[model samples]
Target: MLVVSLIAFVMFRFIGDPVDQMVGLETTLEERAKLREQLGLNEPLPIQFWHFVSKAAQGNLGISYQFKQPVAKLIGERLPATLELSFVSALIALLAGIPMGVYTALRRESILSKLFLTISLIGISLPTFLIGILLIFIFAVILQWLPSFGRGQVVDLGWWSTGFLTVSGLKALILPSITLGLFQMTLIMRLVRSEMLEVLRTDYIKFARARGLKNRVVNFGHALKNTLVPVITITGLQLGSIIAFAIITETVFQWPGMGLLFLQAVQDVDIPIMSAYLLMIAFLFVAINLIVDMLYVVVDPRIRIGGGEA
Candidate 1:
């Protein structure tokens, strides 16, 4: 995470100058120099880096040249929307992926299973942007079921005025969420099916069968439990990627989330806002992985204690 942060920081600072960009080519030489000094752009690289880190540690994060507001405050205001989208997207992905994976695994040799596999493969092959567009075409253009772009008013700690879990919000969400979730679900489905298959072939599962254990208990209780470690790990990693993807999807959907802000900031070369946004995303990714690690220990005792003891 620190390495990624360093890379993002170095790229943003050294790759270009916000001062020069804001100054424009028409500005006089003296104006450019003055603006550079004003924004601390004239400082030595080491000093500038220190200044950024020190101010960041103190919760400053500098001020945006475009917005004329503290970067931290600006990010804080936008953070909720991003979080809302991310959580909703993840929920949709997991809900769809896990069950699909389980069913595919249980019926791996069936024609239906093969159809699912084909669909999953195609889904995994397609890009999110393409999927987003396709979804918009069907649901937005043809069906006239929901709005194709833009978010509704966020009120009452919810994304839609109808409600967070209401039919309207969920209906609006289906397209974007499924578009975002498609690739991830495809990947997770394959993983879960393969893992469950391996677990089902284990000697304990055979023994349980010999003992006349119910198929549900053998499959869901026994095989599923053993397969959870890898599922949990992959799910955590995918969550980080999903947040990044949601940024793109949000822009495609014209949603007022952190992703749209990041896209605009990049286009306008708003370095301060971009930098702060990148840092926040970095923190979210690290925090999510940490939570997943903790969950791993709780879900599987072998990871917590010495494997030899087990």
Candidate 2:
């Protein structure tokens, strides 16, 4: 968090002047100086960073120069959309990827398995923006099935709003979610296939087969279960990547999410929003890793037992 804060603060020095963005051509030098002073842009770099860090620790992310609203408030409004998109994307990846991986591993010689492998390769090879564009062309343009952009109609529930409650909202999510998740799905599929093949070759798997355990039991109950630890780690990291890199997909879809906001901040040099985004993303990465570590114990008792022994 500290490192991220430092980087974000340093951006203010080189990324154009906020005062220039805020002031008009008619503003006098004295007015610009006063505005700078008020915004603390006139202060020493170290002093400004210190103030930023101290206030951020207390949940005060400062106000955006562009929006003229609190950074936290802006983020809070956008966070749900990003999270919902990411959640649905991750769910699609796991639900489709895992089963396909298992089938491909078990039926490597089958034509259907070969076809799946080809599709997975395509998913991995296509860039996200291109995939999004293709989906829009097919579904929104030619087929005229789903809406091409926007969140549709969002329903507000007190402090939070969501798109899941509306028909248009769900349709709007399909293209973006598939675009964001395709690479992750391919990755998870490949990893699972490789892990399953390796696990099947192990002595324990052979022993289970010798013991006359059913193939389904030996494959899913044993091999699949053992594959989950590494899968959990990768999935956790990928979730963070999805959120951090959702900028491209959001831009392509014009989704009102944090990634889109961050892109706009970059264009306008809105330092407060940029800084808050970095800190929030870093915190999310840290939290996800911690959760992955905890999941290790739950998924594999061996990890807990080994730690206890150590």
Q: Best TM-score goes to which candidate?
A: 2
Q: What is candidate 2's lDDT per residue for 195-260, written digit by digit as tens?
A: 999998999999999999999999999999988878999999999999988999999999999999
Q: How well is each residue in 1-310 modelled by candidate 1, as lDDT tens digits?
A: 5565566567668757677677667999898888778888777877877787777767788887778788887776666666666677778767877788888899878887888899999898888898999999998999999878765544454422322555555566667777778888888888888999899899999999999999999998898999889999998999888887788788788866678888888887888888877777787789889999999889888778957776
Per-residue error at 150 for model 1, in Å? Answer: 1.3
Q: What residue pairs are clashing in model 1? A: none
Q: Per-prediction TM-score, please?
A: 0.89, 0.96
Give, for candidate 2, the lowest lDDT window spanning 10 residues. Answer: 8-17
Candidate 1 off by > 4 Å = 24-34, 156-170, 307-310
